[model samples]
Target: MSESKDFLRSIVEEDLKSGKYKEVITRFPPEPNGFPHIGHAKSICINFGIASDYNGHCNLRMDDTNPTKEETKYVEALKDAVQWLGFDWGKNVYYTSDYFQKIYNYAVELIKMGKAYVDSVDEEQMREYRGTVTEAGKRSEYANRTVEENLELFEKMKNGEFKDGEHVLRAKIDMGAANMKLRDPLLYRIRHVNHHRTGDEWSIYPMYDFAHCLSDYIEGVTHSICTLEFENNRDIYNWVLDTLGLELPRPYQHEFARLGINYTVMSKRKLLELVEEGKVSGWDDPRMPTIAGYKRRGYTKESILNFCDQIGIAKANSMVDVAQLEFCIRDDLNTKVPRVLTVLDPLKVTIVNYEGSEVIDAPYYPHDVPKEGSRDIPFSNEIYIERDDFNENPPKGYFRLTPEQPVRLRHGFIISCKEVIKDETGKVVELKVEYHADSKSGSDTSGIKVKSAIQWVSAKEAIKAEVRVYDRLYANEAPESLEDLNSSSLTVIKDALIEPAIVTEKIDERFQFERQGYFYADPIDYTDEKPVFNKIVGLKDSWGKKTAPKQESKTESKKQAKNEQVVGTEVAMSDEQQALFDKYTSELKLNAEVSNIIARDEKLSSFYADALAELNSPVGIANIVVTEVARELKEKEANELNFTAKQVSQLVKMVDDKTISSKIAKQVFEEMVKSGDNPDKIVEAKGLVQISDPSVISPIIAEVIEKNPDNVEKFKAGNNKLLGFFVGQVLKATGGKANPQVVNKLVAQALK
Candidate 1:
């Protein structure tokens, strides 16, 4: 895959091309107030990725401006996270406190130049006078102090002559400026607490707004990248740099959208709440959105970088679906990880035709994944398969282990369920199956064929281990306010049976537990006596199309290709199907394709007709039913899916009303196929509603233009094709839910 330069990287490319700076220098300045989350990971990648691409030095700076919440522990953890993400800061690692003297000297320079002043107002009075955006701020009584008087007070603040919050240094910027951040923001505050690294040398600490810009100046940084929330602060960032008269190559501030993934809160405060409330185990809990949590959960560092790259830099905030992240991990590990058999929910099976234990050589890697090695798996008369794989009273389309039905044992022989044994409560305890002697894998001669083939482990030799499964941390797609935190995010299967090979693997090993999901040997909990595994991601996407199964050659593969399910009602369509059959055959005057489909089953035909009847669009509904619905029915019956006829009406209505473009509607409908949820609920839950309203979309467009100034200029200079690029950017910002017509019009207006 080719790498696409993000807006930030594009800026670097232009600077390099235009000779704006000899070399690019960026920094990842984390505050060390809390553990790093996925949002911070994006920042780290952006900063380091740019510097590496430009062949320039990158700095890992600790912006420990506040001593109250800062600690050495967090500093160490942050460093570990950056290093684990595969970034080397080299020898340029720095701290803002390291330049305390220089920052203090710059503050004195500001005071001598009358650009900064000391204020004796109390904290309450200070905030009261700072005023809202609509109201102009009132100047402090102490703001008009003489330059010598202000200098004396500032020195006193540093020497502990003033108590905490008694006196502070404030910049002399406009008190009534329209941009609130420029309204004489505080330069320094009195903090009597001892610093973590500097100790009790100074009683006052520089505020972040003041220390950040000056530190960048002192370090000669070329560009300072921040999240969108800091865009308003950029004015103050420049005010400080210009007021201090910093030399050339002064750092320029740029803002990009921060990553806010669905199902997890990126706010440090909220993540801390989860840890403090016992909602999760700790910061490193596998369910946490923290980088450490991801590491503990078996996610590769490369996968995180890949995910960050996939979601490139944007100017407007949007919630990315968590499934995309899951896809990255699954894709990263798919071909590289070995395959194994693990029964999560076990059911006992007894082979009546087999007398003793027989060893079968099973390839450790699937044919799609190229690797050599086979493990001798001992198969006995008794073994275990997944409990859900068997059915006493089979459903209409159940294919696995019904009574008297033969199913192939993975890498073993074909077995037929002869009898099902039950305990006193009539609960099934064991299945008695007869195995065909000639049906052994690789040498099968039996002409019999079965639709189901399942993975199993020998009951006598299988290793017992605990497998921890994880779901999304929050039930809501956008947990903006912790609206719906999922209570059952973690599940532990205590008696999972795995092949013996899994027990001896290394701690960092990952494997595909056939039919289950990709799992990792729990690095923190694995033991030789009792192994533990963590489920990284499931094989099947619950919110989209089913991942295509691994392709297998019919000559060497034991698994059967999927076949369309036959409806149980063979004689006639049900009453529901009959009514739809009559409608399509007579009044609607549809073709044989519609009539033949509706004649297959009463309920299914009714489902198709109901969708068409509600939408009153035959061709559209017919294509959807013949294609999407038919494809889904291979795995489950029409009635078994969560999809409803009414949702189809809603989906078609979206296309008709232009609520969603045809492209986005297809995505919505596909999600409906996977989850069987309503289109409206899916749209609302996933933040997929179109942004046709100008008030909602104009700011996004303006920001996109502001971020990609070069591109906007080129578009204005006769590059009409860039119009599609801008439209695509808006679509991405809105998660592909923006109406194209509105976006095209608004983008043209903004460009003009």
Candidate 2:
């Protein structure tokens, strides 16, 4: 599916060209102990994807060596995850437990060759005997046992004559080996647990190291690809196969880094705990990182596959921004799913002047989407809009409805608020609006202009639904405990309203729910009487909006992957460039990765150097130069730029001196780009001074807290991610003039 070759694929391609084997064979061997997460998805894509690319076969193998932990349900889940990701394991599914007899026979042969022995050390004693990284272990006295004696004891042990921990089989490898795994590692462990497949047929089960290589050889696997954690175990993998004098075309293991996304956990133990402890509904909980979770949440197979391909393969472990995954889903659904109007938080509206109801034809997809199909959308005097669409005290850039402002109902008439109706509690329950008779979408004569069109559903014909909005599982970017679980990860809107065509027409299982996000009908729970839609992902890159200096809009984050993600075309640095990189990292204290990217681009490097000369704030100056200034320098030389490097330094100085926030600096930079004005003048004219005064920002934070009681509860319940939400809201309220640092402190305190 991809043109260029990763390291693993390169190996397979070379092996085939060199006639190393007649056909390439790979296997995805997951231990059936827990559900597979996104990490396993990466491995499955690699092993099965390479096989498909090379016209080979990939066997789906279950490495069920630990009977105590293995289960049949987990095996099925693993199989389902692979198939759901759109891959097939040719022929029959393979299980390592099926080869227990053969593996035991190989162990017997090793004993006959005086290369194996049975050790009778307790658990703590075994650890002590294995020695440390620096020290070498002494050979056990049992290593000197006769081959016949060892064979008898091994047979007796297998015959269930020994207790669970009485004895164990170990390869008589180098006891003094530096690699701890090679220091006569255990070939078999004693476990009285019932086997999921073999049942109680035998008391002995071969360990993973003793069985995996043999299973691969027995199945004629050519390339054994695995994650980096198994790199050290490769020696044992090879030692077992080579020492046995296995047939040619034996599998050779290759390692690649596993997938790791921030704000999520991939450990099976952690995931299992999440399921077993009822932290989530199940392993298939949409908030979990499991493959079934993603599928249940409405993510398409194409999106997950594209994510794996776009992230590419790497040799070193790295934490990917979850935003990359979000971008992939949005990109996939942008042109594929139908755009339907669904309001999660509905606000009722009554058109006072409009008299009659009519059905207007609305395209299922926007004009940008290539597909063409329209559904009947009922337009009535009474309709429901998103509660967030209307504001009593509208902000500076508020485009939705307000008392003094008019908004167009999507696919319907333009309406202005004539009155606001409230309940006894003083909450605005409904809006009495008057509509422009000729201002309907697609054809208008009254010449009315509204700020923006808001999604609405006819109160008479709208379908009621349960929309489950799922957020990330962890509050912390790098989670360390169960306490990091996001309490507000799942928000269920039981009374969500949607247009009739969504349920009656049923164009697709997945849909872009207008301004909300992409959603999928709950396969297990959806019914004609009760429709349950789970939000797959938001419309934009949420992690970006939350992490950026200011909240980025959908249009701003439209091509985040295109702008932020790039192939590491890290050209070999010249001596002069290397010196610059070294100085930037050591003397200037610039981030090494950021410095590397800038140092490689000649125009960016020159501009960065000039900016650095103007200001001693290496980090701040380098940031603006590489990001904003570099954006201009990309298509034009530094000399052709409107703003000079000195202007960039001045912008950084304003941010450093607390005269402006980084968010304000960004605005000032944009102004400089447009008019080549000094940042100081831009800040002065716009009155964009940093609001460091706690007196001003604290009240704003208090108002945000009052407005978002749900988020306030979430923050108190360990959902630290909501702190950004509160901060972004305050900043928006202040028209980006609030000091983010003060807002952050005040919000945390208010929420607490």
Candidate 3:
């Protein structure tokens, strides 16, 4: 939001600071041949943002010069995408067709000045004559046509005397120019195709290189901004503007790096191919990188703009991790959207002790999100939970429903599984449980506790919906170059169950589906009769395991203790390690283990200092630096991380402040390590945050209690040693950061 630090902005700022331009004016010119993608979003922000910051104006110019590829549909889609990004062009919207006559007059003036001529080279011959980057082009024989003859021929060409590609107008610049773009580029091409806007008014259309610069000049665009691909075209841009002897203060072209996302190809041609071939549903397919695609996928306008801002304009070309973009949207939605519960793979649970149904009042703002509202969801003896929530033969650390484990029914009471009913095929058909009669969510008299609480929808009140989970369209980093694509990008679940409130919610509303992921009503498919929702992203990075404390055996501890000061025992320490170690331990108050590991590396020390600068919490950062960062540094050098110390510090602070759990932090840290990206970005991109608010965590814990009846019995029968085991289970179930103190107290009360 502050003055942009991008190279393009620096020039604009210098121009503004100086009296060169009274007011800045810029334009977002799209060819209107295809739908705009995330690449255009960056340009829109740059051009429009600069103009806005300087109190100037920006024009939305649809470059409909080549009407053969342009269409009314594309123009509308472009406008919709711009508006969806929360920008307005006001009365500054214009089309290249609007300036056809003016540009024609400029071309005529060039003919008069003998700076242009008519050429009759065929398309194939022109390609042969137009030399490569390393070669000088051969001049066309028709380049020397007399000005009077050229003017007459041009008039005849415009009058429809020339067939398509039979004749062309060429600038008379040097043929031997090193820049092929400047080697007498074609100023106009004869095309008999009717224009989308002009409609047969002229047989010839001015080329983009000729029309673009002139359009900017005509509209008083002070700064003509484009992507790096157009850098070579700037020479011809200036030549046309200068050759016509245009008025003073002509628009100057500036280029910056375009947005390139991993696993996303922004080529309009490729994207169109995908749509036409049914590789994707349409241009607005949530998997596509197009602006419309993101909008339909529950990505907020604020998030896209934030993403553009974070990946600010640069001159150099680079591939940005898509996680950065995801982070932006997730961060924006986190505190604003309410949380909801939906089960994609439903498994029925029968509470044997409860006879009838009841209504539980649950806060819509159960999570950390700052919201206010409550919804009455039906709670009955019969409910549908996620199929994966129950495991008959549970893993060692599994915290959800087991054969004899008690778990809490979120927003209701604690329940323990009494029996597991299976079909003939051995698939879990139903789970019979008994609920703690007095353990109501609020104002409970029955002492009950849980390690995990699983969400469930009342079987009687459940709403059936089709849920679509979308993943990266391309599994490879650069799918543009690779032939292989991710064929399984979209997975459709036909029988997901949602609470009653989801049916009444408006389209495009975002909600965290409890332990699942953030989802939104499909803008086009969602309906009252048969609802559809798209899983925007999962709660954690679905790609990896959650962060758990690394257990050390007594032998390993003894080994580490014996070689505490030995170099390269686990990692090589630098000569500066002692000083940094003392400083962090005594001055910064960081733990010994973390300081010992981090001080050995200059990059880690700098990262530590930077993180310390942003966050005052040393222990929080130390935990990550020692465990997560050290693990990464063991194999690679610090420079390879591609992240700054400030990013590390911010991530540490997020965990220290309990914005996300240590388990969730591990997921974020993994992404950061892989991409060398910012921690905040990884968290946002992956939705790796811990929900510690009582409203959300209480239900999850209750489910854990009810699912583990045998553990509860043991604790009650003088086996107090199971307390730590119960706490570990709760932590594991809740992604490892469940307000430990709160879970401990609740567990103690439940066993009482």
Candidate 4:
């Protein structure tokens, strides 16, 4: 495989070289149940990206099988998302509904071959018959029906003779096989609901596993690519084709990790709920993670594509920190957008020593940017500066305007605060400042040095505009529910002051609001009468920790880490604790370190014991109790905990089942702490299921490596100590959700 090509591209290139069909045809098959999000964007990029790279063609297909929820609006949304990302789906868009007849014909073929049966068992009974993972599923007695009888029942189902769930056509793949999906998986089910496209033409719809492969076959899709969650379905994908004696060189299934961003929900159901529940304005709410949301929020298509390119493709699934995403917008807009003055929280500043107004010619683009555009910024004696720019009693490293510090009004003359005016509430409402007449921006003669230039708008010429400052929508990095909806997500500065040039002159839609954030002219709300601007993104600090205060000071944390030792610490455990730890490690197979931490505390041990009683998972239970439950226990007694042992046990079971990752379990645990909600409900509510198929983490890992080349070179030079640093970097990038094992292995190989 070429170094530049990802695994999917590699597959495409090899297939084309081997003459596995002349063209590399792929499809972006999205079910139109909800608006497409960035996850869909990744799929769009991949399917179209592969096709484009190989000089092939990709078809935009709507797998609109489930008519219960699918809507024309969602279908239009899917199309919009694809086109907005700058891709063409050829002349005709495909719909699975269009091939219903062909799909039904294939099902009839399966029945004629005695490979499928019409099962009359109820939905509940079918589930029970599917059985547990360890135990083999039992075939329904209805499976004993002859092929002719089954065909009659299926025809009845299609003719709308059967009610919903009365009967389902199941593939006769396997009953005692370990892969339970093949345990007579449903080929088709009768749904009386109306399909968006098909209308009342068909009452029975083919299952995803049934229709997907056949659709790919009919479409001549060379490579059937999907997210890792469908890895098991690949078995069925091939089985249907192999059983049917389909044409040679049929599409082969391949899986890639789906994109998952921290602090956002990607599940279409959850997103739909958010839209329906009025938590957001709509699917296109600027705060939503949907492609339309990002577009409405002023994210350029180029930036979105660049982010997809930067994140790259990976094989393992993991949570990606939203900081990396935020960084992408900042990086993209830094050079492309213009700079303008806008005060979010205006504090009136009067140049007491100044006389008249003046027009200051300031270039819209910063000095570093190569764009050529300048606007005459109106400056006068009365101006409005950001309230934050003037701290009455400044901090030690304060740089902006204060009683003592002198600052330059960006593109205008330097000013010194002479007097502070306050209202009855003691809030600094205004500032009286003196300006240096000769210290104009272009021709400065004053020898005084200022730390920074703050943005300001002339009170007389300032346009009254509403600036909506947007923050991360979810309060928790892994959102739990409406409870996690950030209260400060949308803060509207109704009367923010901006330089008149933006309103008067013909300027670009997006602009960097001087010291605040990238601002977009609100496409839906901006007008001459009522100017509105949406904050696209804030200027990211170097490390991107919410533009944190003193978080960049890693010295103390490093010193503490060196003292405690990252490998292991000599944790003091009682004799009773020691004995418990020994039993946990030796008998229960718990990690020695986790066992030690849990056993060291009587309350934790008690909680751990109760959880163990509920579910006999020693390692999983002990890990959470030690790291997470223990922390909560540190501040409160066990009885005071919001959650119970049984809840913790259920959480561990989810981890054991790979339903959620251990890192995600921590998130669920936090929500559990707040509301004492059951772990399962929390997971479902938050859509906290882990997305395996790790390729999404690859680009982030590469980024972490690139940002710390010194550590990379050191690791290559045999300083093995840096391995933890690299792992930590990756973990931090993933909000501690990237598989540590994967990170350790990937980092080691990359450094080599």
Best lDDT goes to which candidate?
A: 2
**Residue 573 in candidate 4 has what lDDT?**
38
Q: List the residue pairs that clash in candidate 1.
A: 574-602, 577-602, 642-676, 643-676
Model 2, stretches more than 4 Å misplaced? 1-3, 544-752
Question: What range of 10 consecutive residues in model 4 has the weakest lDDT sum?
Answer: 564-573
- Per-residue alpha-carbon lDDT of model 2 for 659-694, expressed as tens digits? 998767877887898899999998999888988789
Of the pair 1 and 3, which is ahead by TM-score?
Answer: 3
Model 1's TM-score against the true structure: 0.73
For model 1, the superposed segments whose C-alpha errors exceed 4 Å read 1-4, 480-483, 505-508, 543-752
lDDT of 3 at 674: 62
Query: How do the residues 669-710 of candidate 4 rate in per-residue lDDT, one tens digit apiece?
Result: 888999999999988987767644468777887888887787
Over the stretch 1-752, how does candidate 3's per-residue lDDT look in tens digits? Answer: 33115677788889988878988999999999999999999989988888876778999999998978989989999899888876779865799999999999999999999899999988899999988888888989998788889999999999999888899999999878988888889999888898888899989999999999999999999999988999999999999998888888889999898888877898988988899888888989999888888878888888888789767778888998786676566556655666677888888998898997778888776333345787888998899888877889875555667877877777788888899999999999998998888888776687654555678999988999998888778755567633546656788999999998877754237787876667888889888889888878654332211111237553564455455532111222344665676676556655333455567667667766766778887777766675567556656776676665677787777877777766677667666666888877676765656655777666766787797798788888999977876776777676565777677777677668
Relative to the unseen true structure, what is the C-alpha lDDT of residue 192 in candidate 3, on a scale of 0 to 100?
88
lDDT of 4: 0.82
- Residue 277 displacement in candidate 3 (angstroms): 0.7
User: Best to worst by lDDT, what's the order?
Assistant: 2, 4, 1, 3
lDDT of each: 0.80, 0.83, 0.78, 0.82
Q: Cα-based RMSD of the predictions, in order?
A: 15.3, 19.8, 16.6, 18.6
Question: Can you tell me which runs of candidate 4 are displaced by over 4 Å?
Answer: 541-752
Which scores greater on lDDT, model 1 or model 2? 2
lDDT of 3: 0.78
